[model samples]
Target chain A: MVSVAFKKNLKEKYGIEFNNEDLLERAFTHSSYANEHHGKHNYEKLEFLGDAVLELAISDYLYRNYPKLNEGQLTRMRSNIVRTEGFSEFAKEVGFQNEIYLGNGEEKSGARNRKTLLEDVFEAFNGALFLDQGMSAVQRFLKQTVYPLIDEGDFDASRDYKTELQEKLQINGAIDIKYEVIAEDESVPTFTVQLLVNNQKVATGTGRNKKAAEQQAAAKALKK
Target chain B: MVSVAFKKNLKEKYGIEFNNEDLLERAFTHSSYANEHHGKHNYEKLEFLGDAVLELAISDYLYRNYPKLNEGQLTRMRSNIVRTEGFSEFAKEVGFQNEIYLGNGEEKSGARNRKTLLEDVFEAFNGALFLDQGMSAVQRFLKQTVYPLIDEGDFDASRDYKTELQEKLQINGAIDIKYEVIAEDESVPTFTVQLLVNNQKVATGTGRNKKAAEQQAAAKALKK
Candidate 1:
């Protein structure tokens, strides 16, 4: 049985009242708890949906706010903002640990403090919010909570492999840099990329796809 | 240089004129073309973002429209709608083959007609839409175009793996069915799941995550 006081506390903390209290309850209910409660409640499905909703909300915020930023910069920023560490921290800040329902085993193991568990629960909560309300509500919640963490000014702060390779080659007086997919294996569907600096093969790398292989080759070139 | 007539035709077909011509140009410009055109234009970055955006849009639509549908069903529906065959057909219908910019080699090889290429370009176009008009516009376009195709009773017409598995088990007089993640491998970060019918293992499968493993198990159970 879910506590009415718990529901009230969550509403107060989030500053939003839920019409379907069961949605909120479902968000907080962990798989361990669901197992213990004989499959009465679980956050698994909600977490799946929430993960998608969270990605969209974050992507939308980034796209709208940063008009001048390139795809690579936006991707890195998005990754930083949405990673498990960030979600876990946000969950702790929002007092999700106290609200989460865990089985006796999970409680004894301190599962609420686990970063992956908390992150999954946070995603599940977002999913529940989207299901209960709509995209608009989820977007508003993301804008209010998560959007502020990303700094547009720090877009080019990190040295990506491609950038690093270009810089390294330029310093060494290499005029032109080129990446070519040299070979593709059909069995594993792996692509082999060759990095050329001034018509000379500088490095080679393989990956599951061309972009990944190119990144790897660039990383290798940077190292050399 | 991209042909002006080609661009105009695309504008008429897509029903949205581009705010940034560069975005549209980039959407049509393949990596092969970019390689030939001094790397000034390409669809790789757009394709990455588009993939995420497409997944989110489809997931959101499925969650909202199907209240009784589970995560696996939603995922399968998304995959079916976004797969190479689906995208290839959609791309052909939308005149993407005519609009795409390809290198001489790619053009000679009929890359525009290739299923993988069509899928990539379609996703790249999605990225272009997101960049040019913002998330709202992209969301609207996705809801209008892609959502209808999924919701038009054709997608729901097919029997799903879970449903088949359930029906089969019921017919076989197996009163109890359960999916359990029996093992977790830290090396590959994979989970091994087993489908149990009447307290006996009916099928076993492994995947990168527990949900995937469970789905695989269900799929195997259906095959059995």
Candidate 2:
């Protein structure tokens, strides 16, 4: 059951007051809970609508905000943010962990803490908001939350590859990795970088800049 | 260059008049054309934004109009419509093929008829419309075009599997294909169907109804 305190907190924190409180409740209700509760509506439909809304909002934000970035770059950045892991992080930040209603079995299994469930609830929340308000209100909610994160370069895909590779490779122990400029073409201003893991050639990447080439190399290496 | 007649036609046909004609022109301008013409902007960015807009619009339409459908069914139907082949058909219907500006090379290669290009142009056009007017206008346009097609069950995923399977298996000549009820559980009200091709069982599926079971069986057979 949704608490009055939770409703008050939403109204105060985000200036959101739901006319249809049931919709809000539906957003937080897991399928497991619905199954146990005799065909009560779950968050799945809301999640579906919310997913689309998020995609469009993010795409619009990236398109309007990042003027210099090409479509491909903007696309990569949007993809980085509009994913399960990314949404889970946002859900966590919004304190959704405690808000979600789970079945006794799911609660026993600690399903509330699961990233996929968190992601779904996040989307479901947005969908409910969209239904109650509209796209502008949803955009306002995102402005308070997601837009700032984007401004902080939290979901920058360009910087992500190299950082992800380093984090992943370093998890085992301290490991030596090098990205060396193997070739430079002044005509096209292209730089080719060779990536080495423990002094062994792993991947080579070519791009318009050194950072881009290194990121590409890291991306290729990660695939391996 | 975008023709005045094109603008007039849009106004006459769809009652759509762009405040920024350049944006409309940009939507129709191909990247290849932009490269040849000294980087004078292209449709890629618009296409990216348009893709999202279309997704959300379709999602909203499906959610509101098809209340009985589960999230999974709605998702599958959306996927069927929001694909390259599907968009290309819509683009052709909207007469986008002639409106697109391609490079000399692309034009010589007969790229105007290419499904990929048509799809891109379709997205670009929607994106441009979104930028010019907004979601409501795009919804109106889709109501005039796409919504009708959807009403006709043109992209129905449930019926699609059986039809697609039959079409694929019967490309050369008429082939004997049959759907047999293998099992029925009255307690659970479950129907199990076996898909047979050339008098040999290819796949089996279970569902709530015989039609659903047949579709599932066909889907499995198609996978094989």
Query: Model 2, B87-183: lDDT tens per residue?
Result: 7766766678888888899999999999899888888999999999999999999997788768766667777788999999999899999999989
Binned by DockQ into CAPRI classes (incorrect, acceptable, medium, high), candidate 1 is acceptable
Structural similarity to truth (TM-score) of each candidate: 0.58, 0.75
Q: Give the Å error, residue A164, model 2.
A: 7.3
lDDT of candidate 2? 0.86
All candidates: CA RMSD (Å)? 16.3, 12.2
Note the residue pairs that clash in candidate 1: none
Q: Considering every candidate listed, which one attains the maximal TM-score? A: 2
Off by over 4 Å in 1: A1-22, A32-41, A61-83, A131-149, A152-224, B1-22, B32-41, B131-224
Tell how far residue B3 is off in model 2, in angstroms.
2.3
